[model samples]
Target chain A: MTARIGVVTFPGSLDDRDTQRAIRLAGAEPVALWHKDKDLHQVDAVVLPGGFSYGDYLRAGAISRFSPVMETVIEQAKAGLPVLGICNGFQILTEAHLLPGGMLGNDHLHFICRDQKLRVENADTAWTVDYASGQEIHIPLKNMDGRYVADEYTLDKLEAEGRVVFRYLDFNPNGSLRDIAGITNEAGNVVGLMPHPEHATEPLIGTGRTDGLPFFTSILKKLVNA
Target chain B: MARVVVDVMLKPEILDPQGQAVQRALPRLGFDGISDVRQGKRFELEVEGPVDEAALARIHDLAESFLANTVIEDFTVKIEEVAEAVK
Candidate 1:
């Protein structure tokens, strides 16, 4: 049976369709989830796509963290539901308190959009089981508030727990702490990253490199085997 | 009336390429004397009423928990009787 995954669409969300396409390309059913809809549509996992939700008012992801669907996402994530937050979605995860730390403005105080290089730090998460730890991959990263920050205690905890999933391999674009490109919760189900993996899943549209397909495929395999 | 100021930033462990890029541009902008510039944002909030000490504490909670990222950014809170400052 093909696995079903849900991609949420929030107002101002720009990457929902791309995420859906990635899910479909990975041989999984892509279900469209609305921000106001509380049900997850019986999907195996959820991807909160990147965007400027709620026009990024008050702070990035601050207002949208209270959306109806996030309440359910938060509860289910705590119970070990697999969730991936990309870029602004990562912002929402932090805002919802599902993940540690927060995202701030780029250190240069300007919008940054580019193809970013990253190294896979931990490959054991629900969404990253397909990649080898320490592997290098390049993906597109575009956002204004993309800096990742946390307290020293929290950083130590994340590092000590092996929850730091991705790190900047060649260059640091947004000045994230410890060069952390992404991280997972203690349960290993919730993964949040600042890069746009969904944008790198297709061969023709991108550099013909599917460097990010593993994220979708890994979760589908987890569901198939579960 | 009282106000709170929160400044959040990224940690020093990571390289701030953007900040460095801007620092490099400062000399070319005819501001050759200026150097070493770093950038971040500031948020100032006005409290609703006679905010008790507990309410002020709540604001700090908001700062550390969600308002400010403690890892990359260091935040300082200043709770001054703005009514006196204004007068």
Candidate 2:
């Protein structure tokens, strides 16, 4: 059976179309979930695309955290549903307490746009099973507020739990601790990343490498076997 | 009424490349003796009513959930009673 994956669209979201396309390319049915809608359309998993939601007022994801759609998402994510938040979506997850830590302004105090290199640190997560542990991949990372921040205890806990799914390779662009690039929840279902993986789904577009496609494929492969 | 001040900054475990860049630039720019520098922000708020405890708690939530990134930064919420509110 073809799995139905939901891609949420909040006000100011920009990459939802690409995410939907990536899902389709991965052979999964993409369902659009509006920020105002309460129903999830009975999808198998969810993806939160990135953007300056609500003009990024009062911090990047603070306002979006209070949206009606997030009310349902919070419930679903807590129930162990596979959830992936990219960039600003990552910001939303943290703001809603679905994930830990916070994303701050870029360390350079300037917007950064580049193809970032990241190493897969955890392969057990639903969003990363397609990639081998320690595999390195490149994806677009463009954002003004991309610095990841957290306390020592939380950082150590994430590392100890093997929740650190991705770590920046060679260089850390946004001043993230321990070169961390992405993370996942304890259930290996909820994952969040600062890089724009949706933009890397197609080969002919930029780097001609579909390193990001694995994220979508990983979830699809899981649903197929389940 | 009382006033509170909050200070927030990224934890040392997290790389502050910008801070390092600024520090590196300072020595070259002839700003000698400036050995260390870490960038951060501070906020102040005033609250009225008898719920000083509640107001302080709310401020901490605001700092943790919004103002500061608990992942890389720890925040200190300084709550001080600024004489009492006018009757």
Candidate 3:
């Protein structure tokens, strides 16, 4: 049986379709989940795609975190459900407190769009199992509020616990502290990152590299094996 | 009717690039001697009925949980008295 991965579409979501396509490319069934719907339809995993939900009002992901769907997403995610949040999705995760810290405006105070290099620092997470630790890959990064910040204590704890899953390589885009590009929860079932892996899943498109396809395949393999 | 105000500001330790940009432009505009500038948001809510201690406490909770992200910001709540119209 094929694994079913759900992609949530909140108001103003721009990448839900692209994320669904990426899931399909990874050999998993893509389920479209709405923000108002409380049911997850028993999907094996969930992906919060990038986009300005609720017009980015009251903060990038603030209002969306209180949405009805997130009520369920948060509860299920805590129970060990695998969840991946990309870009704005990452913002939502942090706002929901499923992940720590918060995203602020880029230090440069500008929207940046580029093919960014990243190193996989931890590969044991539910969303990153297919990648080898220390592997370097390029994925597209774009956002205005992409700078990641947290208290010194939380930063130290995340580092000590191996929760920092990905780091910027060569150049640190958006000025995330310690060059953190991604992180996972303690259980490793929840992961959030600023880069758009869905955009890099096809070799013929975008940067002509399929480096981000593994994120989808990784979760699919994990769910099927379970 | 009563008016309640909530002021949200980023923590002093966090960087405020937008505020800095405004500060940088001030010297060029002949507005000098300003040592620093910090940007923040102000929200005014209109509520019906008296804003007793219980209502004020509720607003405090709202400011803490939804009006501002405590991780990066601080907020204060104030009650603004509405002046009666001239007869």
**CA lDDT of every candidate:** 0.85, 0.87, 0.94
Residue A145 of model 3 has an lDDT of 84
- Say which candidate scores most in DockQ: 3
Query: For residues A1-226, what per-residue lDDT tens digits would candidate 3 score against the true structure?
Result: 8999999999989999999999999999999999999999999899999999998899999999999999999999999999999999999999999999999999888899999999999999999999999899999999988999998999999999999999989987787999998999999999999999999999898668999999999999999999
State the lDDT of candidate 2 residue by residue for B1-87, as single tens digits.
667889987676666666777899997898999877787768877666654677779888989877775655779999765765589
What range of 10 consecutive residues in model 2 chain B has the weakest lDDT sum?
B44-53
Superposed model 1: Cα runs more than 4 Å off: B1-87
Q: Chain B TM per candidate, please?
A: 0.71, 0.72, 0.93
For model 2, the local distance difference test gives 0.87
Give model 1's TM-score for chain A to 2 decimal places.
0.98
Models sorted by DockQ, best on top: 3, 2, 1
What is every candidate's alpha-carbon RMSD to the true fold?
Answer: 4.2, 3.9, 1.1
Which candidate should be chosen as best, given TM-score against the real structure? 3
Which of the two, 2 or 3, has more lDDT?
3
By lDDT: ranked, best first? 3, 2, 1
**Clash pairs, model 3 backbone:** none
Worst 10 residues of 1 chain A by lDDT: A201-210
